[model samples]
Target: MNDWRSHFGFHTTPFTRELAVAQRFPLPMFDEVLTALSRAVDQRGSAALVAPAGTGKTALLRALVDQLPEARYRVHYVKVTDLSKRDLCREIAVACGAQPAGSFPMLVRRLQEHFLSTLADDGVRPVLVLDDSHGLRPEVLGIFQILTNFEMDSRLVLSVLFVGQPPLRDLLRQPAHEAVTRRLVHLATLRLLSRPESHRYLAHRCTIAGATTIPFDPGAQEAVYEIACGNLRATDQLAAKALEVAHDAGAAIVDSAHLATSRRLLWP
Candidate 1:
């Protein structure tokens, strides 16, 4: 077979990792998450997104970025690390387009100046989105307070969005982290879809890929749900692989057999 997408009459690769914002499925949970996080950033408030792996944390982060207007908000995505406080400042400085060189205190001043300048000069609120933040050390996570100290915390010049897995929630709940935790205005979460939502999600993905009709039969859909348990990334991987398996076997539509083959090929 040439390619599964072609065999299935798809104009583009379905269940792909890269998708335009407009092409994203209208999952109610995703919409709710975006709305809550967007509201937090718009109000110059901080937030945390805690979800398990493959629940679409990165996708939702990208969507939230698109949701915020560039003219109003300058979003900086910082890759989290277990670095020292000064090194972490360097990382954040680099993300904020500030010169990433200085002692810890100097770097903090410089970053504060940069943020104040952006707000004063361009009328833009700078947002720091830290992904994989569950990996950040307690000392490093404490840096949020230093980052947000604007005019004795009276001025709201920056917003920090913490994106991580469930452990992040527990990490933030520590008594030592109470100051930073208090700053978070919202905590958004993404969940595995229900069975019916999984079916609709697959259909919506097919539509987004320019398919005239969904190719997964009922049996195949159920199999994917049972195996993937409605995690968005898992569903995408299983369904895409199942389509390939079906195409290789010259099947007209994906069925439970194809899904079973996909399970073996993917898991075993």
Candidate 2:
């Protein structure tokens, strides 16, 4: 029988298969975010999720959207890195399936009206997900405050969720932003994965990629854990490179040498 390594190309590494592998990796903190966001969505309150880069914030949001039953909610995902109020409004209008019939201000008001009406008709609140919200300008963010006007006494007609880096928490702390910050009833700050968690993460990804057994040697796992520093992105990168190194060396199983090469390629 041909060796497993011989069947797959030398360049076929876990990194190249990240999308497929990542889907199978059980993000442990995902449940926390899901619970928090689900509560916020159900309660019709605002939510803020803050985390460092590569802590899987975006992935969590996508997963949350996927898990939510479509019959109950309409989720609109937006990335607000560098947008003017008008542009932001336009994006929201588009996502909500409303066409603005007049000037930007008039369009915004119309969009707001349309959103509230749609929620009322559908019997389900609308969820607007703002990714990288820290970069939003004060004026653009003010537009978000305007959206809060759609709320009723019982629940919000529209709910907004802000996901961003650590600075977002600091930004919200400013006195001028207090009104908006006060509306955020749900919040979560994601942290790097623990060592054991990281191990499970890597194993999960490898298994998803068709590896029946742990691909890396015991010592190699330690090296990967150290080099990845508990970051999922770095872990994926290292694992991919290690797989490539093993493939190129014609090794049936990944070992320390492959990990060493992976480290040099990733960090250097």
Candidate 3:
């Protein structure tokens, strides 16, 4: 147990990365993005979720998986950072419970068959979440043509979601990657929070972590916002460390000075 968690009278650690889906911060923008992506998958369409690091893309995906009904949607999430076409095929095969051994062409064919069978036999749609896709080379992204195509482009049997950083938005716009870009029916991204939102978010994280009262005073909240610039993950890190600094000094509430010191410890 961290000394700060005990000092603050929290039942659990505040501002942590490990949060339950039910306990997720109730941000309206998160719900909006999830609904749009859910609607696209419902219609058997592809989509992209582009967000900068620490803006909560991964947490959003967790909520997305929960939103998709297990009985109706065969959702498989595979993180695709720097993976080759064959490596990606193997990862998807494993996610779908298929043997992950074959030539690249054979793997593709096998995956298509598995997706089709899942839909035809079980009345479930297959949704592939290709996460961290900004690392994919343009040529590697071309694999989407085969995955999304079936029966000479007459059947739509698979729905894919590309979740990645901002570069992914530009990568999809390149002419060489038009095939995959054209297949996307919805695009979404998370924005950095405004100053007011940052304060509310800090309080929410505190409450959810079982705090009776938020320890960060108004000035400390503003200090964190100034340094983290309203990024969710950044706020988490800054607030958590500031609490430690305050605890070390035997301070009951965190203040701007503690936040300033925490920033230097973190970044410098």
Candidate 4:
């Protein structure tokens, strides 16, 4: 049998590979978002999920995408940050496999028409997952309101799910954005993982990376949880570094020394 230890170097975790980590350390709070998304997609309604930075919002979205039944709906995930309204529309249009012919307004119209046609042909609702929506300009955010108009009497043809940080909630609260905000039937905010949850998260990542058992000592685990401040992103960063330190030292298990070294290296 191949030695699992040899998997080192090739086994590092990445921030973008959220589906793998989410499977190992499932966050229960995201279940509400998943349930809401599934129901909204079925009913063709709209929903929004918001949380603080480093609270695993991206990871939760990735997990939802991974869990979503491919046969039931067409999913288009887009991250809108620092992009102009025209650029955003073009990107969304391209994701849906349609090219816009003219200006920004024309592109929006084309995207809506394309989405409606797609839903009719595929017999499935079109789901648009917009991430970092808080970064969108007021005009661009208005595009979502326009899309929501493409709906039937009982079901919507296009369903939009907005995911972002707390500023997204603040943006929705603005009176100017009331139209889009009012259509959001479901709202959820992801919370930081509790202490035990953090511990489990670290151990889970280690195991997924091929470690048969947790390499961190009890004290080291506590230190990680404390310094990570309940954020999964921070925990993963610290834990991964600790593992690297242990691997380099040929230590079978990570101890207080490894934890201290990793902490100093990461935070200081």
Candidate 5:
């Protein structure tokens, strides 16, 4: 069967969630968040990144990891769920290259010492980036405060970053978690793209995929922004589906009709 790539003369599928760091869309809002998070990491401080679903939170975390140089930073990226505190610490210990086979208390001490030695002996930064942290329980979140406390909290040996959806903010706001919240040096929230930015984003994706000209009609572009509400992931899904629908129908450009059909076919 003929695919959209052949129909559109694309080098690869456009509007995919797969982000090639070299070719990522240069969004100014993302840059601003990156700057704040980067500064927090540099200072060996913790920060919170909160955004709604489909707003490119995972992509932003990957970009942040890529931008931090390996020579100076030892970064461990962990995607957390509702695991128990012991299980979570074991995962963290494994990520830090420490033995995860000890008792729960031993595991915690091992990770704390690992972070300390990583900075004091190796002279490199240890950054713990936790993604999807909204599911972490209140008590589990408190473990970070204890782990980050080294040398009587007089010195910082590690940097921690929490990336999750909006519920994470509410989670942190709870009275019990206020201690964890106070440790955050920055709180960055990602917003949806503006209408003009969304238009440019579509063009940018098309250009990166080797399209000499945009295949999405102006009306289709407007439909995408409207239906997807400028969420990056939603835009990708809708745009890719529209392309397939247009190609199947032998349409030269994806129009409002194609977008409407694609949305119905995808959602309903």
Candidate 6:
């Protein structure tokens, strides 16, 4: 099998999810959100990022983490899973480099002390990033208020950033979760790319992969935008399959016909 990278004159596969920080495309949609999150972090406040699936929510989180200065922020990223409150605290304890073996109540106190000591001893703000928080159980999410409370929530010792899909926003809006919602300094949302932006997005991916010229033709790009509706993950899947179809056909450039085949193979 001909390697797609070499076949397409790319140093690496384009449209991959695991893009290096330096190689990540600048997403303008996230600029305001980045600023808001950074401000929240500086103020030791909390923020929520809501977006539809495949719209680069995780990517935006990574970008935000990358932009934050290490000297000022100790960022700990956690991908929330369906777990009991005790298990969740264990996960957080591990992330913060604290002992994870303990009773539920003891674990909470230990994590709290770790956060306080991280600030008092290291003099760097600790920012906890929870990705896919929409999956968190209501009871588990509620624990955040208790975890963040220091001196009755008057002194903010830890900044928390929650990144999730729209369901997360709905979860936060419920009266039951008011304790967590009230602490939110900002709520940012991400949208799919526009038509023109989709074109540039593809080109940017290609350029970063070491392509001097875009291998996807204009019509093919339009087909991708139409099929994926500008969602980054969908676009990436369609574009990657389209490239494979084009390469298999010994085509120099991906065209509408390749995209059509990709849509059929990928969706059907």
Where in model 6 is the C-alpha error above 4 Å?
Answer: none
User: Which 10-residue window of candidate 4 scores lowest in summed lDDT?
Assistant: 1-10
Q: How many angstroms is residue 103 displaced in model 2 relative to the true structure, after the best TM-score fit?
A: 3.6
Specify the poorest-scoring 10-residue window by lDDT in model 1: 1-10
Tens digits of per-residue lDDT, candidate 4, 91-184, equal 8987788884579889988988888887788776688999988887766787788877755434467889988888888888889889988888
* Per-residue alpha-carbon lDDT of candidate 2 for residues 151-223, written as tens digits (9 for 90 to 100): 5434467788999998888788888778788888988878888888888887777665566677777877878
lDDT of 1 by residue, 114-186 (tens): 9999999999899999998998888887879988889998999899999998999999999999999999999
Ten residues in sequence with the least summed lDDT for candidate 6? 21-30
lDDT of 6 by residue, 81-183 (tens): 9999999999888988999998999998998899999899989989999999998998888889988999777789998899998899889999999989999
Error of 2 at 255 (Å): 2.8
Candidate 1 positional error at 133, Å:
1.2
In angstroms, give how far residue 42 of model 4 lies from its true place: 1.8
Looking at candidate 3, the ten consecutive residues that score lowest on lDDT are 1-10
Every model: Cα RMSD to truth: 1.4, 3.2, 1.1, 3.1, 1.2, 1.4
Compare candidates 1 and 4 on TM-score and give the better one.
1
Rank the models by TM-score, top first: 3, 5, 6, 1, 4, 2
In candidate 3, position 77 carries an lDDT of 84
In Å, residue 103's CA in model 5 sits off its true spot by 2.3
Given candidate 5, what's the lDDT at residue 172?
94
Instruction: Kindly list the per-residue Cα lDDT of model 5 for residues 1-268, writing each as its tens digit.
Output: 2578868878888987777987888988889999999999998899999999888788888888899988889999888988888999999988889988777788889999999888888788999999999989877988998989988899988899999999899999999988889999999999998998899989999999888989999999999999988889889999999999999999989999999999998896
| Top lDDT prediction, candidate number | 3
Give the distance in Å from residue 75's predicted Cα in candidate 6 to where it truly belongs.
1.1
Arrange candidates, best lDDT first. Answer: 3, 1, 5, 6, 4, 2
Tens-place lDDT per residue, model 3, 1-268, is 5578978879898888898899988889999999999999998999999999999998999999998899999899888867788988998899889889989999999999999999999999999998898888777888998989999999999999999999999999999888889999999999999998998899889999888899999999999999999999989999999998999999999999999999999997
